[model samples]
Target: MSNLHARDYQPDRQGTLDGIRVLDLSRLFAGNVLTQLLGDFGAEVIKIEPPEGDTLRGWKTEGIETHWKIYARNKKSLCLSLRDPRAIEIIRKLVPSAQILVESFRPGVLEKMGLSPDALLALNPSLVVVRISGWGQDGPYAQRPGFGTVIEGVSGFAAINGFADREPVLPPMYLADGVAGLYGASAAMIALREAEMKGRGQVIDLSLLDPLFAILGPQAANYRLTGKVKPRTGSRSTNSAPRNVYRCSDGHYVSLSGSIQKMTERLFRAIGRAELIDDPRFRTNSDRLRHAEELDAIIGAFIGERTQQENVAFFEEAEVTIGPIYDTPQIMADPHVIAREVIADYPDPEMGHIPMHHVVPRFAQTPGSIRTPAPALGQHNRELLAEIGISPAAYDELKLAGVICGG
Candidate 1:
């Protein structure tokens, strides 16, 4: 349904970051997600990996072939072993031409590689350096290795995310890392915009913990102001009763929320329980909340007899707040999501037409694109080296010396 032609979809031409070049030296979820965000907005992102490649190359549960094919999309890849002098020399040659450098190693890894922010800035003072880390570049745990799961646990997000009666559990995905990457990318953009105005670049030290800690939001505020640590209350509205998921006939689930008296009455009327509106315990929201357990029993008894479609139709016609508990398959099959074009088909040389989620905050003019497939290890090593004016003989020599690899 998109009217734009592939030829006319010049990525950089649309986004404000039209001519920005990013040297991405990060890997795994956090760093990769950030680079993907920038790439989506028209920046030219060159992802650098070690010869063995990013560890995420094996992320897919199915197999390496599938994992590597999809995770590295929309960018060029260059595999270089930074420990080698030739590799360092090659990176140095790249610095002068780059507008930004995004790296996600432990605190001192870049300095050890002789490509610290200070050194890179010395070569190109206009370069913005974004360093992503679990604990940031300094502090007691700065050098410690961590992943999304660790941050989730430490940040107390896992503590308030499960059923009240059950032990706390981590969310089943890498939400912490993914969100951190998004925030990091946002910070990078702001810094870049400021640099363009001042004609001077700045460094962004983005800590995964910062975003993780900030996610607590109101809950943190509650604890700070009231000394109360919020506990998990699955599907239950904090302020009202009868605002939770309920089972319907045909083994389907439906969510209901009627916090206001009018909405509650509408819900009751929809279920043919208008008489309950006058009942003493159900007269007010406070009264209903006080006897929530009894109210849930009554609501459940009425809802359990109806099929999912029947309940959904009744609620829709009445305009009461209710919705289906959609699983992934259900979401994919939904006509609304389909009409919105919320999914993208990413093509790869190894795997044809891989489906991926669409980027959010769509641009009106220079919309970002997944134009190219994921790189295969060092697929762009020669091209990149050529851009840096490295002769073909030198490229071959570096490859032969194990400083770089060619896919």
Candidate 2:
């Protein structure tokens, strides 16, 4: 049976976030990723797109690479041309009924559109507004046009991610955008909850820089306490020894971490070289780190006898921390991934059972759900307008004026 039909994998009839309504005014990856996440958690997200539609609509493959199809799952699209006063009026009407609003335009763009947080809050005192941007809304670079790669470079992540001998490598994925979206979503959720508690609303100014800054891990701490800045060390960490990726007999790679003494000793024992535990050159983490090349060579020689899978199982059995550097197919085929239902088969309106990477942070009673597929442009325009108290005559007038479009 398909995993979607597995008895235990059923979605909540009453999803934890079932009653919340989110108005998504964001575009591109960062904002869309956030709204998609909220929708997966059962928020009724109404995506308000401009008449030109999301630019990502053109982000396609000749065959089936629909970036919009995946990233925009579980939201209804409502098209409005904000240049028309009617379109602005319609969004103003919708704001009172929405619990949250998310936008990712440059600073001042939404205000120019007449959908500013202060304006919306006047209409709905409890509305949680989340504004996402590459830089913050108030920073010196607030007006600058930026994207994932640019911000990743500016945030110092790209600088410290590549091999020491080569130019700094850009991350394979849109790490900045995606992580910023997560931070925005989390901030929106918290702000919404706080607003509900206080009976007042606030705007969440979530910058892409926040996640880049937060994701620095130890780099920020090291920089804060000392005068030194971090450089690219490839797979090695700043705080530990024997914590780099290694090659196995099958020409596959794996990572092993052993910063603590007991774990390092265990790793030595697992390789049948317990004498290394007492060796002066590798007794402490500091010593092992100083002689990392020698220690890594010794470990690599032992790993040369085993396939990645064999090594993974052997180290796991021996209570050593290790992971096979899995490819996408390998990850999809992993037993633990299957057991966790990390991949979901969502029924798309345009296509059959489209697969999606499932939601995270599971709940026993009211977990998130993938309720609906992404809509075609302006798919829910009329319906959303009707829900927001627009009369048929007014809707027709707006459509005639090129202010509202969907039909």
Candidate 3:
């Protein structure tokens, strides 16, 4: 495999979001994703975990906290048992200095814990409070446990995801949580900008359900017009024909798309089947969609005769759009991925080196940097407490009383 781009932590590098502070009291994927984005852009993110740790820490591969390491980089951890009143007080003290606060608690849990948006906003009028849940804060299902899996099933994504003959399929990855995280990041930035301009804080009611549903793209309107539900067509496009993955002779796969008329003709010519372009069953996009099975059979046969690389080269030479379906190993070895440094290796104490994605949405002048590894649980307890005027004696007492733990 080609060497991955190697990078070292640059703790002093500044980003556009420098001086902004985020207090993250969220667990699992969505919250981490939001804070990670903020942290990458130079916000000082203080992850307030429970004594045990954020739930992401428990998601280990071969007993390594891979998920936590990736998501929690550029963050500081302050582990506290929030059930204890003292820990709650610590959060209240930190609120005055923090510009943003994020939590993924069920709708009323933060209110019950005495850290409601109103309370936090009162502490710092410019504080932006982001509440993430499975559903909206005041809906009928607001109190439901909002795991991403449940939201994925209900968001109508699974309904049209796989082959119609098989049962609906949930995504293999955290699709709901990932989408919500990206939405939350943008929403938080919007809210923060408003707060900065107006000196008034507000609460963001972010739900996994809403963001996931929004991205499904006019499903309700389509159903209204067609009076029919979309069927699960596996990799095939419902509106476009000749858009599917084809197997190669070498057991690899390549995805090909001929979504437009010119592209369909080009593809037909490339595959030495130019006559199919005018054939009654495959003349237009509508005709091809109606006979996609037969069309796929014809295209698949041509692709199946060649190896994946050969097919890719041949199609590119013929000016037809095509690409090999890449697994992780293939992705890591690709020269384009290497030169672009899409993934790079970073020094890690435990694993010696860990591969991580480069900072995203690169800016020309103020690019972000990874300044630190994921913190050991509670690694910043003393440092954070000291910032809030907690002396050594008080810090020791909090530890002794089990109000603080994990470092």
- Stretches > 4 Å off in candidate 1: 1-16, 64-71, 239-241, 259-262, 275-290, 349-351
The CA lDDT at 350 in model 2 is: 55
Name the runs in model 3 displaced over 4 angstroms: none
Tell me which residue pairs clash in candidate 1.
14-366, 72-374
Local error of candidate 1 at residue 33 (angstroms): 0.9
Each model's lDDT: 0.79, 0.84, 0.93
A best-first ranking of the candidates according to their TM-score comes to 3, 2, 1
Top candidate (TM-score): 3
What's the C-alpha lDDT at position 6 in model 3? 80
Please provide, for model 3 over 124-157, each residue's C-alpha lDDT reduced to its tens digit, 9 standing for 90 to 100: 9999999999998998999999999999999999
**How would you encode candidate 1's per-residue C-alpha lDDT over 291-375 as one tens digit per residue?**
8778888888877999888888889899998888889777766677766667655544444455566656677765666555667
Against the true structure, candidate 3 reaches a TM-score of 0.98
**Which candidate gets the maximum lDDT versus the true structure?**
3
What is the lDDT, from 0 to 100, of the residue 224 in candidate 3? Answer: 100
